[model samples]
Target: MSTLQDSGEKPSIYLHRLQVALSVTIKRGGISPEKADQHLLKQFCRGCWDNSLIADLQLEQKKMNPPSFAELLLLLRTEEDKCTAKATRMKQHLGASKQRVLSHSQRAWMSSESEPDVETTETTPSQEQRKSSSAISQPRTTTSKTQRGKPKPWYCFTCGEDGHIASACDNEPNSVLVTTKRKQLKEKQRLWESQNPSADQSPHMAFIQTNGL
Candidate 1:
């Protein structure tokens, strides 16, 4: 069932196929009938690719005691029926509105010679649009997790380029400015490293390790 793709199949038909598969699995001694409900529920959910459908079942899925396979199928069938009915009503409303417009246009054309006021008490397009759009089901809103975007790039102070520091930069290193800076750094380290060891102070960890510990 996890391999089953939606392929534009209706929920009812999908559930039917799932039911048949579960039955076959049970008859083949693949799964015990006692645990078939749980297996069936999982396989059904795995087969559903629609986020909205999954969202609709989240409440049931999160329950302390999850709904049975039969209950899930029944709920899915009800949802499918509701969606079909709403779609049918929306089509009927749109067709009626179109017919009304065509009828009005024909009448106006017939009386084109004599101009007369045509009263329009028809609902506005916005109203009809809202009415038609209301048919779509709204999925449950889930809070999104905090996502870290591409990590802030490294800033190079030497060349002011991103993604690298001065040490890692691959630009020309023989420049006078770079040579002078490196000389100054090495001189400072040499002076520090050459200082005599104080009697009261402890030796450096590296010096101790280099010696007999």
Candidate 2:
């Protein structure tokens, strides 16, 4: 039943529900608030039937004259276009900023992965130089030791050692005596040769003298 205006008014719940339903129907119909005939169009538009607010609308209709619905809707659509363009620009700015942050993060990650944080032992120039010097000195030290350890020839006169005469007894120095003995032996050989001139002749020599000469 239609409630009387003198009966105080509709319940708050009923009015709230009615407004919600009207708003939903208006949006679904794409009817901008500008085109809505706040007076004559009390029911939800777009063929949705509702007569609950007919009396209230009639009272509101007597209050004022609104602009043409179609023209007002056109103005409303233009305003919406401006709002949509502003939203699109804001979205693009947000996307570009997000991409920039992501790129910086990825570059940092790759650098960390490529060059790891490993600890290494570092050698100073002095240490390296000392190592090289030790390497070079090793071979010279070995060569000196080899030369010092080399064996000399054994020359013992009692055992008739290598390259030893009777004068080199017990490895004593007899250089003067050896030279004197050598000179005496040479003189003896010369005297013997003068005493026996034909003593050195062989059988072959005798034969050659008797036959050929």
Candidate 3:
């Protein structure tokens, strides 16, 4: 049927229908074989069908004989199969490329999830508390040593006087002279304490020593 030219049939099916149309036209007989070829070529698009096969058909007709329609149909089928195979290969390549891209994306997502966060790697509260306690405990021993080893003031220890010893209390010396007189006063106080173990031992002696005098 002429309508079969536009149908979504395979190229081989359309070629078979075209051969039937040619046979029916030839049996009706007013037009010659050459005229039938020209009529069919006009009814169908030369470029949409195979231009090379149409040229071969015309060449065969000029030799005073033509191939059978079945032979022509076979050539059309061969070209169609080659085109179909090429299209199938192109589709396969496209599908493989999409799979590779999906694999890469999945790998990146897995690596991101596997890594540890910065906040999670940091020190815990218990570790921080231990460090603070050690720091607080360290200062106590150092503070006690500083308190016990501190230097005494420039004053007499026995009588609690500013400038002179208990034996020189009658002289009443100026306080400014104490800096040069401190060593000699310390010697005399040492000798007095050594000789009089049960002497005055006044509360002022304890006060002077405790106050770092």
Candidate 4:
């Protein structure tokens, strides 16, 4: 006697009870006759209950005029599109404002640090003036003291004597010149040794050989 609109039991709860009764009726058909007849009564009771519940739900839905599945889906899609458009426009506006602010800041900085322009002439000078300027800019030449004194004698490998081969320049200190000249000689010696490994042995080997000798 439990109707779908019974205040004590909710419609969903009543439906659940009905489904259980139908299951029990189907299960009892394989059992004794008395149990089968009792299960058949339960089945009829469950069916009537389910039909009444469904009818009540349909009547409630008609009163409310709820949206169809397709209409609900389209509404959701329209709302999503509107949200996306609004977000895009907001982003664009923010970007434009940022660019404007940056431009204005740059312009203000430029105005504060503005520099004045310098002027230059394009006229040319005369050739004589140019020559004189070039002459002034040229490097000065150094002259040796050979003309003021007697000509110094040159030294030769075959002979050595005063006022002849090596004595005329005996007053000059040659050690400084020798030291300055050693850089080129050292470079040549290194190149020769690299090209001819057995030509000039290392200083250690030379020392050992000389000591033995």
lDDT comparing candidate 4 with the true structure: 0.34
- Tens digit per residue, CA lDDT, model 2, 74-167: 3334443553454445436644334334333322212222221121234433777657756765676554433221121122223333333222
Clashing pairs in 4: none
Between the candidate structures 2 and 4, which one is better when assessed by lDDT? 2
Span of ten consecutive residues with least summed lDDT in model 2: 1-10
Off by over 4 Å in 4: 1-63, 96-213
Per-candidate total of colliding backbone pairs: 0, 0, 0, 0
Give the runs in model 1 whose Cα sits over 4 Å from its true position: 1-3, 59-64, 95-213
Using TM-score as the yardstick, the better of models 1 and 4 is: 1
lDDT of 3 by residue, 84-143 (tens): 564445436644334334333322212222221111223444877657756765666454
Per-candidate Cα lDDT values, in order, are 0.46, 0.36, 0.44, 0.34
Taking the tens digit of each residue's C-alpha lDDT, what string does model 4 give over 1-213?
A: 232323332233333333234334444564443343344334334433334333433423332344332232233345435534544554366543343343332222122222111211245657876676556433321111111111111121123221111111235545544444445445655665555556434533432232221
The list of candidate 2 runs beyond 4 A from truth reads 1-63, 96-213
Candidate 3, superposed: residue stretches over 4 Å from native? 1-4, 33-68, 96-213
TM-score per candidate: 0.40, 0.19, 0.32, 0.17
lDDT of model 3 at position 172: 54
Model 1 RMSD in angstroms: 28.0
Tens-place lDDT digits, model 1, residues 1-213:
454634555554555455556656676888887776676666666776555666776833644455655466567777766655654554366554443454433222122221222323376657766555444312111101111111111233354443333433565433455445445645654444445222222323322232211
lDDT at position 70, candidate 4: 27
